[model samples]
Target: MKLIIAGATGFVAQELIRQSLRHPDIKSVVALARRPVAAPPGAGADGSKLKSVVVKDYDDYPEEVRRELAGADACIWTVAITPSKSKRLPFEEVTRVCQTSTLAALEALHEAGVGRPFRFLYMSGTAAERDQSKTPSWMPEYSLLRGETENRVLAFAAAHSTPSASAPPDFSACVAKAGLITHSYASSLFALGLRLAMGVPSVRLEEVAAAMLQQVTTAHGFEKEPLQNEDLVRIGRRALGEGRA
Candidate 1:
């Protein structure tokens, strides 16, 4: 299957691209980034199956860029301004990158003529609120906005779903709401203790990528809409084990 890894420069996006290249069922990988992405070390071995497509802006897609994205079976969207990282940027910029870019990419993909049953996996954080009406005391604005974005994406999927059995589903979207990502090397004892004290769940980076690929590659797409942290951890572990064997 042809997979598109959007926001290719991010930590998670890079991992997704790396895993997709090694995946046996993945026929091609398109790395979509604002800037050019250098081929990862081992990715060159599958040189023929991997390619990069650079766009001037995430909110704008030129005709040529759309043409390059045509026929893609799935897209893993990792582009978003995390709450922790949004402190330094203006709220407008964060909203544009986190919310506007998402819808723009989806519209571009549709206009590009991506075939039926196209899968879109959005990378959202576990703390993101699902209800926009009630805001949490902590980071209320950011959380609400993220929730609204998720709702928009889910609504888009519903709008595109096939009305009858005779027609194929136009689009299938899944939101993977990950928690604090744990790194084998960077996660120290202090960090682990802090997370535990705060009651925040965490998952390894590898697991996140594995779980996402498994969702799209399966014969049937994800059974649920927003996959929680525990679900990802479980699926990711299984996917990693299968890949090793």
Candidate 2:
């Protein structure tokens, strides 16, 4: 299946691209980012299956960008600003980066003519609060923003996924609420202290990517709207054991 990896230059996005290149089921990978992306070494020999598409503005999809997205069966969106990054930027910029861009991409991808049951998996954080009425103790503003985005995204796809006079919506969306995706250093004292201080759960990077890959590639599409951190860890561990990338 053709897969699109948005925010291709990110740490998580890069790993996802590396895994996608080696995945037997993924026929082609479209890497979308502000700058050109290069596949990881020793993967995707000659990098023939990977194509890098640069987009200057996520708010607007240019003709070339839209053309590149055509026929894609699924997309893994990893384009949100992290909590730490949000602090350094203005709230307006953060919202545009973390929320507005996502909505735009959803609309653009839907228009890309991806056939029935097209999967769009968003990489969200556990801290994101879906209920706007309640204030989140951690990063309340940011969490609410992300939560709002999640609800909007689900609503957009829900409208299409539900049956209508024309047909069932061709689009579907899933939010993977991962928490503190880390590397080997997760066991380190600093990392441990950080996790304890923030009260955030942690999972390995591989696990997050593996579970996402599985959900998007499954023949029947994802089973639910939100897949929590534990679910991802479980699915990822199994996939890694089976050498499934």
Candidate 2: where are CA atoms >4 Å away?
44-46, 162-169, 186-191, 194-198
Highest lDDT against the true fold, candidate: 2
* Model 2 lDDT tens row, 1-245: 89999999988888899889889899899999999898876565437899999999788898888999999989999998889989999999999998899999988987777756688898998989999999888889999999999999889888767475754346888899998788776354555776789766777888889889999987767856699888888888988888987
- Candidate 1: what lDDT? 0.85
RMSD versus native structure for model 2: 2.3
Task: Give lDDT per model, in order.
Answer: 0.85, 0.86
lDDT of 1 by residue, 26-142 (tens): 888899999888666655446577788999889999999999899999999999998888988999999999999999999999889886779999999877887978968768889
